[model samples]
Target: MTDPSQPEDTDPDAEDGFYVLHLFVTGASLHSTRAIANLKQICESYIPGKYSLEVIDVYQQKALAEQEQLIALPLLIKRMPLPERRLVGDLSNTEKVLTGLGLSR
Candidate 1:
């Protein structure tokens, strides 16, 4: 769990929306590595410092996987700013991922 007391880049009380991304991967498979790299690139390029990202390895914490209801590896969960969302797979489709995060028009 993130420390809510620590100051975040964005004002928690501000009206402007922010995003919390949780990525779940399994082991060190090629797909897992690719998803991490690709998602990071997209977030840095599009969302930049506006979002917070947390990567979790289901292989290390199987309980979290079940709790999150993750059906597959390389799952990305958008946890904040209302309308919680998720994307599953290797995250190769940049456009779809962006759309899912409501970052693209």
Candidate 2:
């Protein structure tokens, strides 16, 4: 569970309507590595400095992963900007990711 007393618990971009994303991964597996690279590229291209991504390694943060109720690795959760979204996969499909992030119409 996240401590509300911690500064990291607060969202910095909530006021600006930017993205607060959490990507749950497991170690250095091929899919996790691919998802990391793909997510970074997509954020840099689409949201630029407007997004905050927290890549949580499920192996290291098992409790947090369970808290998120993650059923799959390489899961992307959009936490802010209202109406949260989740995507599961290597995130190779840019169009699908963009649409999920509400970056493209």
Model 2 global lDDT (CA atoms, 0 to 1): 0.85
Model 1 misplaced stretches (Cα beyond 4 Å): 1-16
TM-score of each: 0.81, 0.83
Tens-place lDDT digits, model 1, residues 23-103: 999889999999999999998888777889999999899898898888778999988765677899989999998767766
The residue-by-residue lDDT of candidate 2 on 1-92, one tens digit each, is: 66664344344344457789999998999999999999999999888899999999999998998898988888999988766889999999
TM-score of 1: 0.81
Q: Cα RMSD (Å) between model 2 and the true structure?
A: 8.9
Once superposed on the true structure, which residue ranges of model 2 sit more than 4 Å away at CA? 1-16
User: What are the candidates' C-alpha RMSDs?
Assistant: 8.4, 8.9
- For each candidate, the alpha-carbon lDDT, in order, equals 0.81, 0.85
